[model samples]
Target: MRRLSTIIALFISLSAFADEGMWMLGNLNKQSRQTMKELGLKFPADKIYNPKKTSLTDAVVSFGGFCSGVVVSNDGLVFTNHHCGFSAIQQHSTLQNDYLQDGFVARTHEEELPNPELFVRFLLRTENVTPRVLKAITPGMTEQDRQAITDSIMYAIQDEIYAKDTTLVAVVDPYYGGNEFWLSVYRDYTDVRLVFAPPSSIGKFGWDTDNWVWPRHTGDFSVFRIYAGKDNKPADYSPENVPYHPPYVVPISLAGYKEGTFSMTLGYPGTTERYLSSFGIEEMMNGMNQSMIDVRGVKQAIWKREMERSDAIRIKYASKYDESSNYWKNSTGTNKVIRQQKILERRREMEATLFRWIQDTPAERENLLHLFSSLELNYKARREAGRAMAYFGESFMNGPELVQLALEILNFDYEAEEKMVMSRMKKLLDKYANLDLALDKEVFTAMIKEYRSQVDSLYYPDFYATITDEYNGSDHAFIDSLYAQTKITTPLGLKLFFEQDSTYNIFEDPAISLSIDLLVKMFDIHQVIQEPSTNIERDERLFNAAIRRMYANRNFYPDANSTMRLSFGTVRGYTPFDGAEYDYYTTTRGIIEKAKAHAGDRDFTLEPEVLDFLSSRDYGKYANTDGDMSVCFISNNDITGGNSGSAMFNANGELLGLAFDGNWEAMGSDFIYEPDLQRCIGVDVRYMLFVMEKLGKADHLIKELNLR
Candidate 1:
């Protein structure tokens, strides 16, 4: 039924030298291995990934399913990005013992804080399941039918594996668009605990101001321990659990990197759309990104201003603010680079090449041309609806904390009265667990105002009508009144929300009613774009297949889909613009200078003792050969969002640092990789050891690591 697999090998990258692919670890061919060796990797290919025996694959962890982590000690010590573990650090904090502000250190095993629901999954293996997945599609099948069939097959596969082993979970993910599928199985250990963390001054030194910037000084690393049952198998949290012994735990290399030192990163990168057509790129730039930027710009402004005045608010909302601002700046940088690089024009040029390459096959060529036309038309037809949807998402689903509670309740299945009401109350309790209500009200007002101003009434909730009718069109006054009058806001109403009463009509509450209406309207917009979005998804897959045919001579790596991927390149710097060359690495000197530059800024102002220690020339065994302490470094290794906290290793497969970010100029790397401009920013291993040793005084933890 016309799977693109028959047309061409669905390639995921441009060329070998660009180091542009989030290469599948299990799928590395001989040519890929040769290329890696040429770049700098010293290990034999099989040594890195062998299912029969434990290898480097066992050392990496799917950090909380969102970010990446690596096993440092055989005792299950997992090292991940501080930002990755930010929520857990914040969760254990209190006004009396503010872990977010003071940072955390567990000298003994019992001191390590247990985080509920936090998990680390080890990749069991990845298998190509394209034929099995594609068999679900039939001629004349609707997108809905195609999806339902595929989902059932995938669920069956996962269910079979789960029935065999309770610890194992399986996922079938589509890659190279939907042209290919891969099944990945993992062993999830649920007893992960926070071990060590540096103060915000160290962990998140530059804050949002330096988030995506290069020459980064932030340590950006956190430590956790994975606890397993008596047999070293996955288990729920228990006092009897012991540290897990990994199959392989690479040593930390004290000898630092040269400008051209070889490096590699193995992690799960969430997503990348390197094969998107010109029309899709333009649609995202003009509609989706703009709406996201506009909506978040308002929410973050209010949230950030309030966070500055109050430490309690800052601790409560730091993670939320970081999450919102991250993509806000990402969309900002994405649009900027697209304009500066003329990315849309470049994509059209590539498509033109594909159009000419298949001129000999009239039938195939016509189909290719029709695919392009459909993509352009589809993107154009759904432009306004897509923009409205983005606004709705950024405003309600993400902007207001109450909306999160509302959506959670709407999705949960409450069978009995007591269970339903008690569950609802649990949600209420958790809402205040991490969120500050006063700040939420501030955010709610700003978000609703911006959403109303930017989007049409067609995309808004029925509550907008109430605002116009009962509140005289004043969003500020309406939101304020809603918060003041909503039953959920009152203690009695909250108690009732948790009480054993199935008669509680959650929809009768103003906040819940408004949230439901907004969500319902958002779903309406979603329906309007569904057809075109489905068409785009299908056509994009075919387009990439066509691209593989046009560039059949070049080697390709599959696009990342939150699976284990390996990429290697040299530690190198770049020239962001003419006459401006950035060094490959930054030292503690840069940190001190930045701290001085933004002296009064909370983002840059470090604790006086931290700054004094850096300036005191206490560079000991961990110092770089140049006599300055290395803070962070950059490499050309391919990585993306979920690769945060991935292990960055040297030629000998020894740990060098933790991959935490990519330079700002290459924000569009997700869409198109420019090897010349792109760089993976990592926290040097020595700095992490230094922080743990000097600041945390956790020498016992350092002694556990195999330091070279």
Candidate 2:
């Protein structure tokens, strides 16, 4: 295990990078350039990210990946990526209407459509569960013991809390080594419906070739509404439900952002790996890069071959193929940049500096070196575990039933993991009846063989024992013989055999069931022991320390993952990749021009109806940028995955455009907030209203926008 000093050094360096680095709050160090506060900005008290506040209940309601919308007229009206809304567009698509290919508008409320698996989540709350959780077992607990203790304590806590409101759920987040923890709560509403979507021709003017690389003109925004019971609280979708009214929704503005203007992104920015060790970063750069190259390259080769042979398959996997290719290609470029820049070397130096500082300070020195060593050990374990987890999640594709079974098993503590032998028997009979005999036999045989090869062989010698007999298609015979000998023909007996007594032919049992158990154990091991040993606690301590430092220095409110966050920025652009400069704007006319030049491709065709509307040049509800009103526009707000459907507002918090995509150069914004490269693009509510009112002839929606 690496020492605490070593890990801290690595952590500080990585966190100071280009994309994933977190900026200190309140512009203390950054004031020389610009600050969010300078732009006449005010973040709502409710929206601030305060670790102590503990509830990020409101997630930016988003449709697809690109669009931006706010939860206005609250019955959960989510405005988001137009491309994000594409699936819903396709769902409403038909021979008669073909919304995806054409686009449609709901003239009346009755004409509004619903799509499958489309929903929005409002972050209900978050909790710092550090004391309550860590109280179960102290640091340095054994893996098995740690797993058992955590499960027992966590289950007890959740059962006590969640029993009241099913909506009140919890997910544990390991922070700062094992010293700190957080529990995120969510109010999940599954019944989300599409309120409006423009035709794809207008929404995705340029498609894949133009996706990340944007000169860029795509009005990618869509709208959906959330429904709940009459009491204004969350409830499942029902015929009696009504539109949710949000307590606060941003008001749209005709005023737009100027270059150098300050902006704020007030939504959840998923995760930051800024605190990783230099070793960790190198592994990813080397390991993940190689993996991407292998998988994506192979997949691309296969896809291209299949595309030549089967057009139908090509169309079916078109999105996936493009996504994989883009991921690999971009990753290749990103990795190269990461490697050549000596990012790892710089980070190592930073770690050493921090260590020297810590060692010099006797007042705070608590001999954290042992703790750091433990962290290094855990990192090694985690890397191995990650590989295993990836294979299990994607490649193996465990059956839903087995997944459920595994979750159920892990729901219990260590004693439960060992003692639930009989429960396995009861489940076996039911599962056996459903298993496809041939598939099960083959799958089980292969799984055991693989486990024996990859997993610690000492823990799984019995799995390898059955490989020979099972391969000859004698699995059933072996199972019957084992049952006869053990006098434990029940499913419980079979499970006990696998769990406790590994002498028999447990090979007949499902691999998924065993895999699930293994995975649960792995998670338990990680959370309870390994995670504590690593940087989780140290990171938390550092972050909290940093926060305290900021509070003392600037009196800034510490950032938290609360229900809302208001980040203010401006509408500026920058140069990316090869020094290609991007100006801060794309106009409505750009959409029309792109449509005119389109070659025939499913992702890139103009709907005749929309073309006709564009040809007419009506500009009904469109707000003019300067004297010439343009429909779609851009801003420079630092938003990521969780900020979908967030409203972009002007000085008085009036609606500007609905924010959608960030420039490709800003994908790194997920890890780091870059003022220069990151740009938030949105559809002007004015243009959206214009399209609905004039082109789609849907005065009803225009009326809904309340733009009398």
Candidate 3:
């Protein structure tokens, strides 16, 4: 097996001074500490992450594996972004009790709503398991064989760890690609409850329109409480479970920060491809992103119309719309930033430099050159299949809700499928009572057209031929017919279909038939691209290993894989474009201004009570020294999708805000960090306190926080 030392050295040679990486909590080095100190971090590195003693890392939790949250009170109060908890809020919402629209404030512990599957995981510890795992691989081993051996070893290690501690959820993650591996053990608390949330007027103040925009006034915060058994251990939701006493809780700081104030963010960042080659970037920008944007645009258009028609439909699809629009806008912003920033050209330049450096080192030249060539070829070969897959994802898989239900029903046995089918039918009827068959039909039709036009004819599903020959090439007519003939479209049809005998064939249903055919086509495409995708992964692993070796002396952080990480920076604003400067923070005054500018607009309209409070300027203790109520603030802290709900701390490690969104101009920061432009948007802690006390009138909940 080849070593990665050479590549690390090469990477070190190219390193420069820039705060651009997500440093893992347990792996901070002396240089990282020094950098943090220079950037205004007042706490020692050990104080931030000490396995033997309670530290800041103990306060941070992986919120259901998708977002980050912080423990705020001794009694297990957790703080995160409202968007992070939106799905839970949606689940508990209904027309009679619209928690999403009016928000919910648990005045007493008994009032807190329980979530069925929500969880918060705290890191126990991490150990380097690279050598033990790598011992399984040998030179010239096939990728499949290598993966199998690695998995077996990893599972064995995890089992060994679990044997000693049954409470721990053990996971092994590869860092620097497969060059290094670490075992992370976590204690997952399953009994999480919604404590408090501001109405959508404040929580989702600007909604989709101001999603990634800066100078934002949205108070995008939500509160949840973690419950544990009497033993203070993880347990299922039960009335007997009490508020958990965490090892540490973040102390809220009302001392407002200004431009250049030191700040740090600790959370789980989902993913980044900072080491991607220009070939990969081109494929992502032109193929995957474009397909998602186009397809989701069509889906969202239909959903918006149905949702606006009634409050019930709006409640049913609020989370779905938010989730879909988030990435739709992300794809749009990323493509725009990629072009505007000339990221491809920059990557090409870096590749050129790397190649030149490799050539000088004859020992490494051939291997490095072969890796890049193979990667480029693999990406080129799979671009079309990738685009086709993206379209399939956006269309039949995610376009209409009924298609997914039909596919799920097909997966179950007749004897066991009845209960599942009945439950699904009830849910479908209850949630989507205003089922817009015509709108869904239109969306499905448009998506199918997109897939046919974008993907090659050779890759078309068998049903395409059925539509073209039997239905006369009319997707609209075919989809309309499918809806009319499908059992899952309505509760009566579904119940009637389930009444059939064991001899009944689900494939006879039009929706089920189309779904199965599409699934088969997707499988076929996957088979076609399997080899190339495998080769790409293998080459990327090698490439990452080489980079690690080249930068051996420099402090390197792994790309975020939904694990806890700490990123530090300062509170500073930027000029995203020439002659347009933004302030470091937004205040309640700005919210009022925006409300006035877009009065009656759903996205900008404030609740009448909130409007009245703003009119009187009665912020009380939550007001800044300047007599203004701070809402949102921006920091140069590096963050991504999963960092939402992460704790933004001041120099003294006091809670400053909850990290939410990143600036639009820095959308490409996931792939290529633009230090000057990339900024983390957070809802200030003061704003949360103000909303809880003055607006929400939940001073009891506010009293739980250790305010400074």
Candidate 4:
């Protein structure tokens, strides 16, 4: 075990140059730059990130605050993952013109559909704010106090900027497990509009089945244009808004990638726990991930059954179902990898060395002894509560659509006069306007029963007593009574209730009471776990600092926190098991093979036109040297959730593809980087162009790209 740990640590040192760290752009070290150059970086490090001028970083945008994207033309034409733009596409969809089903392509600027809530933000600057953040920390201050001091300083810095221009978003994020801090200031353009999207059949070809899998045929690309005021500044959605002209636009390389070609991805990777203690990783595997997998399985099954019954229901629940299933499937993969690889035991072995190093010197032992002790204690203390929290969140907060609506009502300002309060409630309900009452009723009942069965009686919502005493422990009966008493469930009742609201008190309603109980129970769990969780967080931070000191000669990258970062590697494949070797790229032939193999399958079902198109011989402009179109390829770039839609660039700093997913074999790499198996799955840029131009017939949008 010690030998294995030492080998892994050494491999991580070597792999740092291959595809390990999500490096900070603001502080590109000399050592990293030289390595990148040796690997075929065409320009200097400044070309990738330069604070004084527009660099490749300027072209990258945080898509709708959740995913990453790149500006492909001077007019701010953004290319992101189809999934990243899915929510907006679904929102704009209607039965009359189903964009989600049939796809949308605007022929002219005027025809483009506006997404008011969606925005893409550019990285204006990233500054090291470590000194400012750490200066106020006292020697013996509690973690909470230290955090409060950090927050005050961060707020003061951001508030000063906000006073000048509210559109300028500034966030001070902790790095290296709060050992250091950096501030990222961004320019957010909110008037983003959909320009082109392929039908779901192409954009999301294999759906959940193909997600996180290698050799993917999913096109997984969407196009949107950022709109700004006449001055090219951020503005609200309006008919008069013009296409945003960006400071820089990334050039698309039509040339494809070789197996060992140098590749890099720059994006906002959501989170990673590479420095997390073994105890924390085990908790994540057995507790949070397990609860998510179990609860979402039930929810997806229920939603799928309901959705298949009616087109109306399908359209209403498409986004909800996909969101749930994607993560649900991801959690299952993470746990599988953790167990198969014995990740928990390996982590413990690594920690053993870390502790042994601490004990070698009395000075080191004196300073860092609390790390393991406190982490072990608090992690054990919070184990059950943490699992309960995950179950409560999955089953209660995210289960039923009406349950979410109930939460919204809980926060509603009911103090307004009758008509105002009624209007507000109607508006709030409209936020989830597509929810099917029947489907929600079924889901809500099942969730209540599932929660009760999974968790202890102490964690039960106060409303559980009503189900037990009044309804004889019948979830269906209790749920039925709640809905029956709520006027909003029926159109006529809602209308009448809205008409005469002066005498009505919704706070006394059964449904409202049930929501309150859910909130109160969630709060109780949070309260119980707060102290222990804090201790664990503090211990982890101390552990992270100590590990860095121990490995002073080795490179240590901070765990991702949804900030702009760059990760580099080669376009290479790997052997997953004893005898099986995977290719670096999957061609168009695989698409036809998959479509035919799973002809009647919903996930593999492609539109007849798309099938015929793939079946036809010539891949034309997108074809590689073998005269076959590249669908997707694999690399070892470190990426996570938010890296979806990020531009994958070749050594020449030209676009190769879009970083969309990570291979399933390395799903647990978020906690522990699997140097041998970890590979980034990306949709070939040429494939995206082929779909946009040949399949979608969006030549105007295709022509707008600065193709090389």
Which ten-residue region of model 3 has the weakest summed lDDT?
Answer: 1-10
Q: After superposition, how far is residue 497 of candidate 2 from its true place, in Å?
A: 26
Off by over 4 Å in 4: 1-15, 413-430, 488-501
Residue 338 miss distance in model 3 (angstroms): 0.8
Candidate 2 C-alpha lDDT tens digits along 1-708: 456655654444333222222232222245412344455555443333343352222434423323334665434556676655664565455456656555666655455665435555554545667688767675666556765766676677667667777776555655433345556554555566776777666776676556655666666676677766787666655677777766555544545556654444445443344445555565565555545654455435555565446544443333445445655655565466455455567556655655555566564346443434554565565665544443333212332233333344434343555324444544444344332333333343344334344445333323234635563645445433433443233456546644666654443444434445556555653454356344443543443353233224432222222233345566666776585666666666676666667666545567677667766666633645454446555566655544555666654445666655555655544333445556676666666666656766666554455332
What digit string (tens of lDDT, one per residue) describes model 3 on residues 1-708?
A: 122544443343245344668987777878888888998888767889888998999999999889999999999999999999998898889899998999999989999999856899999888889999999788899998988888898899999988998999999988876778899989999999998988998999999999999989888989999999999999877999999999898898988898999889999999888876778789888776887788898889878888888887799789989999999999999999999988887676666666666777777785676777888899989988887787777776887776767775666455556645555555544445545567667777777887777778887888788888989988877877888777677766566565764555667878888788888888988998899988887888887767666557766778888888888889999999989998899888898999999987889988787788777888888888989888899988889999999999999999999999999999998887776788999999998988888878898888788999
Candidate 1: segments with Cα more than 4 A from true spot = 1-13, 415-428
The CA-based lDDT of model 3 is what? 0.84
What is the Cα-based lDDT of residue 442 in candidate 4? Answer: 90
Candidate 1 colliding pairs: none
Clashes of 1: 0
Candidate number with greatest lDDT? 4
Indicate the residue-level lDDT of 303 in model 3. 83
lDDT of each: 0.84, 0.51, 0.84, 0.85
| TM-score on alpha carbons, each prediction | 0.95, 0.67, 0.93, 0.95
Query: RMSDs, each prediction?
Result: 3.9, 9.4, 3.9, 2.7
Q: Give the runs in model 2 whose Cα sits over 4 Å from its true position.
A: 1-36, 42-69, 74-76, 90-97, 123-186, 288-337, 340-342, 363-366, 370-565, 577-580, 592-604, 625-635
Steric overlap count per candidate: 0, 69, 15, 0
Against the hidden true structure, what lDDT does model 2 obtain?
0.51
lDDT-superior candidate, 1 or 4? 4
